[model samples]
Target: MTSAAPVATESGVPLRKPRIGLLGIMQALYDHMIPGITERQSGYAREIADRLADVADWTVGRPVKDRTDAEEVMREFVNADLDGVMVVLLTYGPAMRVARLFNENRLPVLLANIQPEPQVTAAWDMADMTYNQGIHGAQDTANAMVRADRSFEVITDDWRAPEFAERVDRWARSARAITAWKSLKVGIFGYAMNDMGDIRVDENALLRALGPEISFVAPGDLYRGSLEVPGAEVDALIAWENARFEVDPDLTAAEREDHARMQLAIEKILVERGYRAYSTHFDAIGEDGRFRRLPLAAASSLMAKGYGYGAEGDALAAAMVYAGHQLIGEGHFTEMYAMDFPSDSILMSHMGEGNWRVARDDEPVRLIHRELGIGRLEAPPTFLFRYRPGPATLACLVSLGGERFRLVVAEGEVLDAAPLPQLEMPYGQFRPDSGVRACMDGWLAAGGPHHQVLNVGRHAEDWRVFCRSSGIEFVQV
Candidate 1:
């Protein structure tokens, strides 16, 4: 079972800043990063502390007691065990010296702080100077860290800014999120079906790049699980068929009861396997001795609608399934399709788990049949509405050019329209996107090699950060 618990890094989730060491330089004010003479300020400091906790499970340590000696802090930051560090400054020792130490350690840093007091023998100006000290501490930390030649970000605002605070929280959360998904596992079922060019995915590259582990799934396991469906659980299939086929009448009791079994079996397989997404070839030709029990129309329909069933069981398609689960928070499964038509809209859907992403304004998908051994059982299917234009990203988990590369990355969009005709499945169903033909053509022309996973999402400036963390290539299309 391919499971997509954590969203893929490249898709809207940013990669974590790896591991970091947090250092709060508060020796100037009672050994606290945020020094406070009043309770309100102290409470603000606590909020900042809570934010750190929200961001990462970090190691907090003392800074240089001697304003002139920050070598120890720098050493700890640069120590191989840590990835980066956050510093809460309450003092402004020699900025240059502190800066040099950080440069040597070369770890990422974040400047965090609240107000601090200043040295005041003159009562007339003491309180004001002290308040200024806290503000300066945060700034000095930022300046020193940046001057030291390390990449650093800053967050000085206190709890008053709840929304912005959450943004900072997301940064720390991003770190944990990347790590959590990096060590995650996804299952891949069956082998790639024919005609879907090699996506050339390199597992090592993926680990080096994305951090997801691909587990192999057997056809027998999937098939065996299908037999375990219970007698109850008819809601899913009935709802699907009814919503899918826009006919005035609904499905009969017998059809609903029967389809329910298949849906139940499908869900059970996912549950038992701990899979977030998967692709498998249910070809009946016995090419690999795998037999076809029930008409895949039912299973395929179930899988495409939000379920993850890729035709040919190709890796690239599996990656697509993975993307749907991660980015869309669901999985979409299907075979490579050709498109050449001019329509303002189209659908991107299947009859399974990931199908929910289809434009609700378009059409719904319906399942049809074909010979299993030959590959690709075709029938017109409706998915929500037309294609979403503008910036989009396409990926693929493929093997070719002597290597298997999982997606890397390509940016594109739904063009004017795809070039294809209305499908001919008995029930009124239509293909999703019309620009696929052009997409494939452009990909082949650009030396994309073969099969790839496709998805659409809003782009951001930090996209590269997303790629680096995910372990896939962020190639320009």
Candidate 2:
């Protein structure tokens, strides 16, 4: 089956900046109203808002003193569709009112219980006492949220503290990612590979649990679109390929044109449908409906252009790739190709669908034609190269049957090794922190799928935060 339909533009994963609603709160204590306490609190609120502006698109709401004021600002946040909210306690505020609004939105929140001064000194006056009244107000807010049955991450420290800023920044990043997830769209152009139960995914479950829209495409639609692409577009793609790749003498012009058309067709689908990630299976594109022309080159090219691409209709792998890229900047589709005990490493690769952007820049990806043994059709061209050597991590989201799912993660080093001449696909050698055998055991223990997302840096921490934010089980092996 095939029907047609796309991350940020760059060689790295682009950050989805969060639009945060910033609110400062205080209770109306008319009896204990201290002069300049409100003004000082307002100034502190401005400072917090300015700090947040460094990491997020923040809108500072007027310091709310009562339910009427809180409701007005809450309405603005709702209308703006904020990814998350940050509530700063200027003084002991009415937690019931604030908690109610937060619970209704059901978005992630940072309950910042920050004091302007790191410490109180002998010279401290009533104004200082009034300004720092937020000290115990944090407990009030926490109690209110607990009563309202709402969850929030708390930072109870001075804004000037390095740790406070770091924690807040991390929360903002996590919120921005959640925003991206809600609007994500993934395209599955064919059915899952047969009999590979481990890699099979339930589209509905994925959509409900992870908040991405899934689109099923028919193969014929893509093929027809490819044929309709203008010859000029194909010619431009060929020219670009010749300039970018180490063209193989064995790759015929006709083969290159066909591959280019496939790339263009896929690109059109992604652009039109707003898909950020996609998957394809050879069996659905074959000549006799068993396999069609190999789309290895097209897949590789798309991956280099910042689109997540997975082979054999691996929607999970593609989505993970997209997520990893969004979180870091670069992600490659890979599998546990083979274990090389002799070198205490594991080899990772797919059928010529590696991201060329992750390959060694000095050694451009080589274009080559290969008979991938999938169909009886003519061999297709593929980009042949290995990923660049660097510290990396592998991440996989596996369905543990029913609606349960778990994330499997492992940190590793991309070792420098000679590519196997016999293997036509792009390959990389990796040495896990736990060694090859132990890593394999861990993978098996976690029930890790063969297909996963590989990225260029240690992203286990980020993945852990994401899993927590999304309520997914995490098994870091």
Give the number of the best model, judged by lDDT. 2
Candidate 1 lDDT over 290-366, as tens digits, reads 33333344434443434444444554455455544433333334323433354422233333223334333345443
Report lDDT (CA) for all predictions: 0.44, 0.77
Which residue runs of candidate 1 sit more than 4 Å off their true CA positions? 1-180, 194-197, 202-209, 234-236, 239-263, 282-311, 315-324, 327-354, 362-373, 376-392, 396-421, 424-457, 460-463, 470-473
**How does candidate 1 fare on TM-score?**
0.56
RMSD of candidate 2 to the truth, in angstroms, is 3.4
Model 2 misplacement above 4 A: 1-16, 30-32, 36-39, 52-54, 133-135, 140-152, 156-158, 161-163, 287-292, 401-403
| RMSD per model, one decimal | 9.0, 3.4
User: What is the alpha-carbon lDDT for the whole of candidate 2?
Assistant: 0.77
CA lDDT of 197 in candidate 2? 79
Error of 2 at 47 (Å): 2.5
Compared with the true structure, the alpha-carbon lDDT of candidate 1 equals 0.44
